[model samples]
Each structure stands twice: as C-alpha cells, then as structure tokens.
Target: MMANTNGYLVGSNLERVLKAGHFAVTAELGPPQSAEGDVIRKKAGLLRGYCDAVNLTDNQTAIVRLSSIAAGAILVQEGLEPIIQMTCRDRNRLAIQSDLLGAAALGIRNLLCLTGDHQTFGNHPSAKNVFDIDSLQMVQMVTAMRDERTFQCGDSFKGPEPRFFVGAAAAPFADPVDFRPLRLAKKAKAGANFIQTQLVYDIPAFEKFMAKVRALGVHKQTYILAGVGPLKSPAMAKYMKSNVPGILVPDELIERMELAGAPWAGKSKEELTKDDKKARSAAWQAEGIQICIELINKLHQIEGVSGVHIMAIEWEDAVRPIVEGAGLSPRPVVTESPPLAAALG
Candidate 1:
C-alpha cells in the first residue's frame, strides 16, 4: 500500500481527501434488484462529482440485491470510487476471503465489513444464519490479509495480497447506548481504520455518543463519518422510527414533516388527488432535505467527526441538493491513481 506524505495509507481519493484534512462527503448507492449494469452506471454518474466515495451496500436490510462487488466494478468503470460492503449473513469464512481476493483482483481498495441483519427480517427469512465469523473477526481477518499477507489460518499468500482501506459500522442510538462507544473501540482495536455510523437524527444523543467515544480515545484511532439523510415523508419517518432497529427519529422531525404536509390536512383519503398528494409529499421531502443540511452543518463542528455519510437510499437525485446546500459542493480534488486496476497493479 502507498502512503501519502502524511504517512496515511490512502488507496482511493476518498482516503486521500479525508487524510488531507478535508471534510469528506460519502453517499450510498443501492444497486438495483436486477442484473443491470446500466442501472449501476446511472447511479454512479449521479454521485460521481458530488461525493469523495460511494458505498455500495451488500444486500442491505438482508434484501437480495445485485452483488455489491459486481456493482462496484461497474462504478469503477464509470470513473467513480466505490466502498464495497461485505456482510457475514450469506457467506462463510472461505467465501468471504475468496470474495475479498476477487474484489482486490478487480481493483477494489475500500471495504466496509458488516455483521448483516438477521435472515428473519429479510425476504429469505427461512434461510439459515451464517455467523461463521462476526464483523469484528471479519475486520481483523481483512487487516491480516492486507498488512501481513496471510490468511486467517496463518497461511502465507502466494501472490500479492489485497490492500484495502478498511471500515466498519456503528449504531450510536442502539440499546444500551453506553456500550456503543466501547463496541466501536473494540472494532478499532480489531483494525477498523474508519467507521460509518447508522443514521443520526437526534443530535443531542449523537453528541453524547461522541463524548463517550472521545473519552475512550477511539476517535484518535479511527476516522468517523456520521450518517445523515432526507426522509421522503411523514410516513417514511414513522416507518423508519418504528421498524428500523437502532434508528432514532425524533418526534420534532416527524412533527415538522406533518406541518409540511398540513396544506392538504383536511382532505379525505379518497378525496385527495394525486397531484395534491405529490405536492404535499414534495413539501415534506423539502423539509427533510433542510433538516439534513442542518445536521451536516452541525456535524462538521463536532470535534471527532471527520465527515458525513449521506445515505439518500433510493433517492439518488436528492444527494446533490443536500451536498450543495451543506456547502460541500465543488468537492476537493485528490490526485490519486485510478481505483482498482491501477491500485492493484
């Protein structure tokens, strides 16, 4: 792995930009359910100039989607940097290591290791759970592959090993919030160079989490990118709050969405026209974007936060507006080598 002048190992522009002391911006790309390279290319194009890197989720929420690594290869072809997400839900240790080798062979340099959601919540609820190695072990294994050129069983590699900018996820709002920071510390000790946290709606709670993180000194060991996004409507907000584990959407945000949709408040469900509903929905989405912008502005002021991860979900078009509104437009240029192909060779 090549180290920049500052001695930070940076394989992609995302790492370069962050290590260069810039407030980095990253977004998520949800690969379509079908095997369509055009869909990946289109989404990549939308995020190309706006973000430092884009994270391609691996079967996010346990829903079956196009493969993250395949979609990442498509993004690389589109001249975009992709952070490929690897979850331990569907694969065992052998498959995981094999995929990592394949991804590196394809020129992928950034990886986000995850302990996937339980299969019971996904479309394949009947499928067996494969906790072959938890995410902590996954992080340690990848670190060993990159730094030691050895497999988890202590076997040496015959050829060049994969060099990745490793990352993991954290949920600051999860139950037993006090344990969240300690959990992050464990991942960092296990070799997570960076972390992208779950969606952060309650800033006060997030501040508390960061305080504990700083106290534990985990912030010094890893770069943290707080997650932010725009909710499409009041229903979307409520759905996420009630159904999504570890996500806390404050009532104030939901109330704000209600106010935005109040223009059509008195209309009966059957009486409301499609156009009226569209306008109301647009109002709520606009408010959502505003809230996201505010959050980004505040997140930058937090001492340990290195950047923001804007997860627009399927609403890719909303990313540009949020980024620009947050004054993160005109992203910095990091003169790094091309991703995957150049990096691997």
Candidate 2:
C-alpha cells in the first residue's frame, strides 16, 4: 500500500490526538455502493474544517458499501483525516492482518474493529456467514501487534510490524446492565485502546452506562466517545425503530417528531441541504444536537471520560454549528508526519 499521500497521517492514531481534558469530535459518513465517490468526497471536503477526523463506515448495517480505505484515500488526498472502519464479518485473520499492515504502510492510522452486522441483515440474505473471529479477538490482534510487534497469533514479522490506535464499539443501551460492563471491559482487556459506542438516545441510560464505565475503571483506561445520530424525519425515526439494533428513540423525541408542525413532517427536514434551521423547527434534529452537546459538555468535566464522536449520517455539514454552539473549540495540534511509512513487507 502507498503512504504519505496527504496530511491525514494516520486515521487510527487519534489515540495520540486526544488530550485528557479536552473534548473532541469525530464525524462519520457512509459511502454509497454506486460510483458515487464524489458524494462522499464532497461531504468530507465540507467537514474538513470542522471535525477532528472523519470516519468512513464499512458496509454499514450489512449493506453493500463503497470501500472505506479507497474512499479514505480520497479524503486524505483532500487534506483531511479519515478514520477507517474495519469489520470482521467480511474478512478473516489473514485478510485482516495483511490489511492492517497495508493500511499502516499507507499511513492510515485510525482503525475501528467491528464484528459487523450478520449477513442476514444485509441486502444479500443468502450470503455465507463468517464469524471466524469476533470483535473481542480482533482487539487482541491489534493489541498484540502493538505490544509484541508481531501477528496476534505469534507470527514473527519480516519487517517493522504494524501498530494501530485501535478502537472498538459498544451499545450501552443494547442489553442488560448486568453484562454490558463486562463485555465492554473484555474488549479493553483484549486490547482496544478507544471505545466508540453505538448510537445513544436515552441520556439517562448513557449516564448509567458511564457509571458502569467509571465503576470498572475502564473509563480511565480507554477513551470513550459517545456516538450520536440526528433524527432527520419521522420516516428516519421509523427506519431506526425497525432496522437499527441497540438504539432506542425516546418517546418524547418520537412524539415531538410526529407531533411536529407541517414543515417537519414534510420534505424540508430531509432535503434542506445545510439548513440547520429546518431541522431545529419541530423536529428531533436540534434535540439530538443539544442532547449530544449537553452530554459532551458534561463528559468533558467528568474525571475519566475523554471525548465524543458525532455520527451525522447525511448531516456532516451541520457538525460545526452544533459543536461551536456547544462552545467546544476545534484545536488540531499539528504533528509532522514520520518519513514515508509505506513500504510493502
């Protein structure tokens, strides 16, 4: 893989970027399957000046998606940081190992290891399943690469081994309270450096999740970023309810959307490009932003919590206002790139 193409030194290296006391924002954008690289590129360009880093989702929700690495290369070329999302459902250890090395060789630093959605959830329901390993093991793999400078299973490296600022995902609102903390800790123990959680709707539930995170001391050990998505319309709300797992929309939010005045229930909420006012009026969009910032401002003051990752699906353009409105400044500390990091092993 080629490296040092642009200013995006390492997308996986945000672990190094995050300061203990400061709040940060990493936005995500999903790629379209068709020849729509421009769509993602244009959005990334718009967000270049706002988000600390932009995440390219990999086949989000088991649907066919454009290659995140390729799309990420485009972002990096445009002088923006790109966080590469890697899912285990699509590749095995060999493929993952090679890809990690290739990514680092290409100077891509950030990596989010996920045990992607089941094949049944995607467009192709008949495709074969590959649970060859899970997200927990994937953490161990990256951790081993970092600490031991070798493959996760103990293979020696012919050249300099790869190291990734590895991240993992969790849904505090997903399951029972009894097992959620344990599962999150397991990934950390297995070697996840950062935790980017599943979408959170209920702030109390998130606070409860934080309590568990604080109780276990993992909050101190890992960088936890609260994930958020703005409800575009009641139709979008309905989609989340029927499709997304581990996400809960508050009755109040739903009520507000359904009970919203004419403009919200119409196409304005969905089509008003770069118009924050439209989303703010009679919709759950502003509520989502305020909720995220309120929680973020609180998270900033929390003893162990670090930052927040805003997943503004198609609303990347609105991130700056939301963040600036919250009074969190975007301070990107410039670090020089290490001499060309790409040399195939």
Candidate 3:
C-alpha cells in the first residue's frame, strides 16, 4: 500500500505527478480478447517508461476483452502503474462498488469512469444493456467510497476503503458542443480528479472549448489530458472524420495523410502489389506518428491542458516515438507513498 506523504487524495503516482506540476503523459493499452497475462506484459513492456501511467481499457468499443481490473493487476506485477477503466454500461452499482474494492485490494490505484459504448455497437448486439448509473454518478459513488468510507447504499465499510485517484472522460466536440463544458463541470463537481478528453484534431475548436473550460473554472479543479491518436491511413482519417462521434479530425490532417502515400498516388489499389501496399502503409503510419507528435506539442502549450493521453490502439510501439518526439520522454519519477498502517506508525 502506498501512503500519501504529500497529502494526496489517493497517493497514486499519477496524483503525485500531476500535483508536482510536471506535464504528465498517459497512454492506453487494450487487453487482448483472450485470457493471456503475457499479452498485457508485452504491451506494458512497450509503454513502461514512455508515460506516467497506462490505462487498461474496459471492453473498449463494447467488444469483450480481458477485464480491465484483471489486466491492471497484471500490470502491477510488471512494475508499471495501471489506471483501470470502469464503465457503467454493463454493471449496476453493486457490481461496480464490488469491483472497485477488488481493484484497490490488488494495488490498482487509479480509475477512469466512463458511460461506456452502447451494446449495439459491440459484437454482442443482442446483449441487454445496463445503465443503472451514468458515468457522472459512478464518479460521485467512488468519491464517497474513498472520502466517506461508505458504500453507495449507505453501508459503512468496517475497515480500509478503496482510496482511488478517480478520473472521467470528456468529449469537447460532442454534440450540443456548447453543453460540453457544463457536463465537464458536473463530473468535476462529482469529484473526478482528472479528465481525459476525446481525441482532438481540430486545434482551433479545442481552443474554443478550453476557453470555455477556463471561464467555468473547471480546469482549476481537475487535471485535463487531451486524447490524441495516430491515424493509420488516409481512409482511417476520413472514417474518423465522417463517422466517429465526438471526434473532430480536421480536413488538413486527412489531406496530410493522403499526401503521405504520394509515391503510390497514381496507382490504383488493384494495380499495386503487396510490396507497394506495404510501403504505402509504412509511409502513412510514419506520417501519422509525426502528426500525433505535433498534436502533443501543441496541446501542451494550451493553458489548461495538463497532459496528453496517447491512444495508439493496437499499435503500442508508436507510443515510444510519440512520447520522445513530443519531448515528454523520461517520464517524471514520483515515489510511491507509504502504506496507511506504516504512515500511522
């Protein structure tokens, strides 16, 4: 158990890093669809020193995968801190609280609460959805569990409580965009210590959103980590721009990705050989990484932006270069706090 010598709420490394005022870096790691611990270890190896903490996604995109808490425990053994993502899409308050206790017991200190993707979006479209409590409510419930040592049902914990560094997601470009800031305020008011936003591509639009966030004074209350991802190819960029909700990719970036494949520009897909396609894919990925690095650098300059959450999806290897390119490598070293019992002694 890590103790908080500096009066941090949870004494997690992430809390210490952010409070120390160092520009923080966090990356996402999706658990494999199978129950393999080595898979988590492999991904952890790639991301170990590149970021402050790695987020273990909970059934991302509604696709079934290794449980976030289980993978987080694996990461704990690998000497890398994990932020277990908890979604309200599948569990009720009881299951949610129980899982929180289990996660904390296993030394998982940070948590990212989410509303989760709709079941209809996943492979199991026939599965019944559970929205017993929304993400905002989840935040509030977890805060109470930590601060008050009480369960959501008003039951008191007899012993140690789950003291977590709570987090929540933010979508600056979500529909009713004007209401985004107000929604963020609700989460902050509910006690989310940090906020990782949806992928940001349009800098100007994000700037406007931040201006609103600063005006509302939400930035002062919580650390904001802008979400950024590498576009795999021009088609990928176009798909995100046209299909993904709450993600706003600028046209300039799409054109940039298109330009990356210029060497094969005149050749149609049918005319290109395997090697040609492979070369073009490599070029596009390289350009994507460069673009991501640029976004991180620019996002760091924003007043309220505390860090960048790099989501490379299955391309975990890109994190190293992206972090290095953004001048955020050699992540800050904040010592873990002492255990509660040791601190009391």
lDDT per prediction?
A: 0.88, 0.71, 0.92
Q: What digit string (tens of lDDT, one per residue) describes model 1 on residues 80-109? A: 999999999899999999999999888788
In terms of TM-score, the best-performing candidate is 3
Model 3 misplacement above 4 A? 1-6, 336-345
Candidates' RMSD to native: 3.9, 6.2, 3.6
The collision pairs in model 1 are: 107-340
**Ten-residue region with minimum lDDT total, candidate 2:** 336-345
Could you arrange the candidates by lDDT from highest to lowest? 3, 1, 2
lDDT of 2: 0.71
Candidate 3: Cα lDDT at 289: 99
Query: Model 2, 1-345: lDDT tens per residue?
Result: 323324332233354356323466788988887767798778887677677777888888888888888777778788777788988888888888888888767766777889888888889989886777888888888767865777867887767767567789887877676788889888788777778888776777778778887899887667788886666666676778767778877777666566653453455546655565545453556655665666566656555556678888778766776678667656455454423332100
lDDT of 3: 0.92
Q: Against the hidden reference, what TM-scores do the models get?
A: 0.94, 0.83, 0.96
Instruction: Count clashing residue pairs in model 3.
Output: 2
Question: lDDT by residue for model 3 over 1-345, one digit each (tens)?
Answer: 333436668777888888777799999999999988899999999998999999999999999999999999999999999999999999999999999999999999999999999989999999998999999999999999988888999998987889999999999999999999999999999999999999999999999999999999998889999999999999999999899999888899999999999999999879999999999999999999999999988899999999999999999999999999988878988775544432310
